[model samples]
Target: MQKLLYLLILIFFSTVAVAQDEDRELLRGTVLYLNSVVTGENVINANTRKATITNNAGQFEMLVKKGDTLVFSAVNYKFKSVVVTQDILDKRRMVVEVKEKVTELDEVVVTPESKERFLELEKEKYKKYDYERDQYTRLQNYATNSGTFYNGINFVNIFNALRGKKKKDQRNNEPLKVSQFLREMYEDEFFVVDLGIPQEDIGKFLFFCDDKIKPADIAGENREFKLLEFLVDQSIAYKKIPKE
Candidate 1:
């Protein structure tokens, strides 16, 4: 009988201690939306397994505990998460500032002239070479200005010189290679749009791009898929950082 009594006392005291610990962990606090123009956001407590939406004033009361994770989500704003801490519980309030989701605008290209019209205008502005008329003019000049013609250098040399100049001009205006184009796309479009990364932080994310999967190396059809996969992987690493 004495042994049994001792066992019951131990069990009762153990249960009370557990209850007290639970009470200490429980935290009550108000979540405040920090947006000046918008209010009423959603708050979820993962640890307590409860959810609440803010009022029109951008505030909500909720119960949480130390180590509980909370998420704030809304249609008009970016999704955010916070981990409950003893400091927050002691303060009994938290101010959450969420950025609005960036809405992409439709692509609008403004041009001074249509391509076909511009090409046609260029052709009209510059005359094409007329071989027969040029030959007649050259013969006329040769007959009328014999002294000038004799003084001129060899015609073959002049022809070769003109051809070389044309070739050099064409080379200077060559189109960019696929590899070069891909590098521009990586900086301008891929990292910014797909990853939702800020312009300033793009340089940081670019370090993660592997040279093997460079845009030029990727097939045209697989460009989007490959870039998306790479961006997703980099995003995971980027999030591990406390601050960008």
Candidate 2:
């Protein structure tokens, strides 16, 4: 009888162990936009390890075991990762909030005429400086023309030539400097737009500019002109107010 009781006790302990393991299993909560709508819906499941898209509102609920890692990702937003904790597991539901991404604009402008002139001068400078022989010429030229140029034709010409030569050399020889060389290494990347033109007229310019200009060109021109118009409109609106 004692042996029989011992066997039963062992069986009972085994069952309890299995139950504990099952309870400790991980769960995941995914947040996605439902039906492409911004309203979020969470799909909750504990037994399976899988990724589920959130509803349109970007909310999801899943059952996860302690120590399981949950990854949150969506288009245009930064990706995030969180490890499940005891507090999270204890909760009946978890709420994940995603913030909208904001893209900042650079205030500098680059005009088509200036771009052409800059490139032309850049080519001339490359030949003059012997950039093909001296690799450091490009880096040096970029450092010299790192800011806006509003006045003095001689300075602009000299600066642009050096910048162009350096940029060409870097593109041919070095791969790491390409992004910086394109963005900050040359002054030709930016153009200034003439703001005296009317906003209605600007639309016409865009249509004409399309054949000759790329998206980057449009953005540079539009951003500068829009900023100018916005400022002018604000000024005019304020002038109409009676002195207080």
Which of the numbered candidates is closest to the native, going by highest lDDT? 1
Write one digit per residue (lDDT tens) for candidate 2, span 116-230: 4434443454446443234322344333334432211222333455446667765565322212322222232121122223344433433333333232321222233332233
TM-score of each candidate structure, all chains considered together: 0.32, 0.27
Q: State the lDDT of candidate 1 residue by residue for 1-244, as single tens digits.
A: 9999999999998897666457644444344433353456788887655678877667777666678788888887788899988888888777777776656654322111233443333234223535224321232222232222211212233333334445677657543233333343343544454455667877665654544354334433323344344446555566467882
Weakest 10 consecutive residues, lDDT, candidate 2? 186-195
Off by over 4 Å in 1: 1-37, 106-244
Predicted structure 2: clash tally: 32
Clashes (candidate 1): 0
Among residues 3 or more apart in sequence or in different chains, the pairs in candidate 1 whose N, CA or C atoms overlap within 3 Å are none
- What's the lDDT for candidate 2? 0.43
Clash statistics: count for each candidate: 0, 32
